[model samples]
Target: MTTHCDFGASLNDYLRDRLVSGIRSESAKQKLLSEASLTFEQATKIVLSMEQAEKSAAALSIGRPERIHQMSSVVARRGRFDNGAQHSKTHSQTARSDNAGAAWRGAGGTAKV
Candidate 1:
């Protein structure tokens, strides 16, 4: 037969260890207790939920599809901008002409004759 004894260390030590191990933060634990008014078991469940979410996100990014898509989109958009600059020159001339008309109207329709 064996007897079990509770460790004399404060609960904070356990919480710090869990947080440092990427399980949950001390602030999060406190928020669960104070803000959420959750019991210890409920707080543990919340912490586990957060941990699972983090794991799931990490798993999703392991393939790096999102990062690859972002990089490709950036490259494609840059290419489009470079190609569109030539087209933009003509459009800008038309825009300036429109702006001049607007300015003429704003100046009480007095033509620059």
Candidate 2:
């Protein structure tokens, strides 16, 4: 059997250290280093997931207020807040066509249409 010379650190440990050093975020680097016997696979998964979440967050922040208003309007039109049940067919039709009639009715004004 042939024996190899012993390095101070195992290859996996060396690779893990290098991976931690390459991370741009100081907190992320610390998080990886804090793990007990962290494996390269685990570090890669954590970093990748963090990156994906950051991208999603950035995308959402671009039109956040407008997106929220649109979502709320859709939910209201779908009668989601009406006792958790959909509006009757007639009301649903009117709401789908023009929400102005529903708004007028709610404001104590009769819609001629």
Candidate 3:
């Protein structure tokens, strides 16, 4: 004998499993479910607002002109380093040093006076 499953129920169960695994915050999960119940326009506006807030925060954190330029330069340098290592003959050494540098930077780099 073969068992049959309800597709709608199966889909809902799959979505619930993904939500539980992907979202660490109970409040966020509930908010997502509630938003899913909204009309398309309302949901679109809510998502846009959330995205705008995130963009604003990122812009604020990166701060003023000079600092923003410096941050961009650092990001560019890291990207070049990453790309160069991808093409280098001694890729393992470069990768190891990159990991060590990241750890050291995270530890505050032995602060010099």
TM-score: which candidate is best?
A: 2
lDDT of 1 by residue, 4-111 (tens): 646455454555445435634665555564643344456566778867887898988896988899988987878744744545358878898888898888889974
Native-vs-model 1 lDDT?
Answer: 0.64
Alpha-carbon deviation at 50 in model 1, angstroms? 0.7
TM-score of candidate 2 versus the correct structure, residues matched by position: 0.46
- In candidate 3, what are the lDDT values of residues 1-113, reduced to their tens digit? 11365565355556454544575556544555675454435544555566677789888877487887888998887884464455644888888777888887877995222
Error of 2 at 75 (Å): 20
Global Cα lDDT for candidate 3: 0.62
Order of quality (TM-score)? 2, 1, 3
Clashes per candidate, residues 3 or more apart or on different chains = 0, 0, 0
Q: Name the runs in model 2 displaced over 4 angstroms.
A: 1-9, 65-113
**Candidate 1: Cα lDDT at 74:** 86
- Reference-based TM-score of each model: 0.45, 0.46, 0.29
| The candidate that achieves the highest lDDT relative to the unseen native structure | 2
Given candidate 2, what's the lDDT at residue 113? 49
- Residue 91's lDDT within candidate 3 is 83
List clashing residue pairs in candidate 1: none
Q: Model-by-model lDDT, in order?
A: 0.64, 0.78, 0.62
For model 1, the run of ten residues with the poorest summed lDDT: 1-10
